[model samples]
Target: MSLRFSDTVHGVDLPNNAMLPPFDDAWVTSWGAERRDGIYVSRPMTLQVFHTRLLEHAKCNNVTERFGVTRDTGAPAVSDGILWGVASWGIRKLCGTERFPAMFSYLASKSNLDFLTNGTQILMSDKRHYPYPDNLFNNRAETTPPSTTS
Candidate 1:
């Protein structure tokens, strides 16, 4: 059976690039983010749901078959679309659960915050491009926990 929006493996389905809007399909779902203020301190409900769901799927559901499709060179393997790998770093840091390895790098030269909060369109017209729909608001450097030794 094909996956639907309600299909849940611990309450989430795997994702892919085709999951992008204008390209979404049966096994994948998509969402768009809207502008908001206090973006650093106040979580946008849209983005909160996004990163949260990604975390849930990683819990005890590593590389599940429920997410597999019979399209990978005439053999079936659990899907590993670009979306999964890209978001992995932040989510893993937040919850200590490793999913995909992040491929996105911070643009020290540019800021996504400005465009996300003021763009006329909710998503970039080229929705499939990286950092377009993703609209990364912030990135944290890998930091060590504080040491107790004086």
Candidate 2:
């Protein structure tokens, strides 16, 4: 019952460290973001993470990639969204897994996302955000070729 989600990240500022905040309807409303066809594109987010809501909770050890997000506003008229980090969740120890891959990431269907979050969130963080605490900001030093992954 181990469920994992990983992807070859794109357009992310390398060495990115982010916190996908838990779904908060009020907060989203505050920023005037709305759901369309059951999806949300929160304007309160900056680079896949909340810009100022970073100190309200402790960081969770892991989280699932539950939905796709698109940024429809920016200088170029549309800013490509940020990275999609991985999670090794299994109904429990969701404190997950991530791999720096060189190619071909998995594309799971909506049913797959349902299997993970039980239909409560479209794109939510797992309740937390701790201090950046270090200069490296999680600089990864390892990367694996995509072909050999399990």
lDDT of 1 by residue, 1-150 (tens): 965554342222223222322222112222222323412233235412222122221243452212211111111111223223222122322222233322222221123323432463333222233322332323332222223378
After superposition, the stretches of candidate 2 with alpha carbons farther than 4 Å from their true spots are 1-13, 17-80, 92-131, 135-150
lDDT at position 70, candidate 2: 29
**Clash numbers, per candidate:** 0, 1
TM-score of each: 0.17, 0.18
| Cα-lDDT of candidate 2 | 0.25
Model 2 C-alpha RMSD to native: 17.4
Q: What lDDT would each prediction earn against the true structure?
A: 0.26, 0.25
- Lowest-lDDT window of 10 residues in candidate 1? 68-77
Which portions of model 1 miss their true places by more than 4 Å? 1-52, 56-61, 65-113, 121-138, 141-150
